[model samples]
Target: MPYKAGHPCFESGCAKIIPHGQKYCDEHKKMHPEEIRNSSTRGYSSRWRRESKIFLKAHPLCAICEKNGRYTKATVVDHIKPHRGDQELFWDRDNWQALCKPCHDRKTWTEDKCPVYHY
Candidate 1:
């Protein structure tokens, strides 16, 4: 099949066309090297996925929802304390809580101090 030109670089105001199969132009890609690295390194790893699956299997209900008298099924294993990319903290089962997606999102927003929407 003939190669189709990709969309413009994701970086605002960058008109450079990205090569097929690439998300960013060469210049923007270079400008955000840390983002590329963090994308690969940060968040849940394979081990985390395995462990979280086991955890959720054992604890199938949202901890926060339980406290509020709700019975939501847990879908995420959240760290009680912010792991901040620390492997030890990330893997600490004692620091984990099984949370439903809404509870996890609410907890994260509260912990991150994200601005509340008035609507």
Candidate 2:
């Protein structure tokens, strides 16, 4: 379906109409880079995965949910603080939390001011 004439592009200051089912216009889409990176390249390497598996095994329930008296199974090993690409912080097990998908997504959205799109 074609976009309505007045629908603005998602990119800031661009007045172009967004195509149906797309967040951005053709121009903005081309300008934007890939939103997410592969786990291996984004520092979630094989080692990280292995460690995360071990951590998750030990912490099978979501920490936040557990604190709230809920028992949700954990699927993500998240850093308590923003790592900001810092190697030390990224690998710090003490600063980690076991989170279910919803809990992790909510926390990340709060921290980053953006939604976690799993494309």
TM-scores, in order shown? 0.63, 0.67
Angstrom error at residue 78, model 1:
0.4
Residue-by-residue lDDT tens digits, candidate 1, 73-100: 9999988987656677778899999999
Question: Which stretches of model 2 miss by more than 4 angstroms?
Answer: 1-10, 15-37, 114-119
Alpha carbon lDDT of each predicted model: 0.80, 0.80
lDDT at residue 28 of model 1 (Cα atoms): 77
Q: Give the range where candidate 2 is weakest over 10 consecutive residues by summed lDDT.
A: 30-39
> In candidate 2, what are the lDDT values of residues 1-119, reduced to their tens digit?
86465578888898887655566777767554344344566588889989999999999999999999999999999999866566788898999999999999999888855433332
* C-alpha lDDT (0 to 100) for residue 113 of candidate 1: 44
Using alpha carbons, what is the TM-score of model 1? 0.63
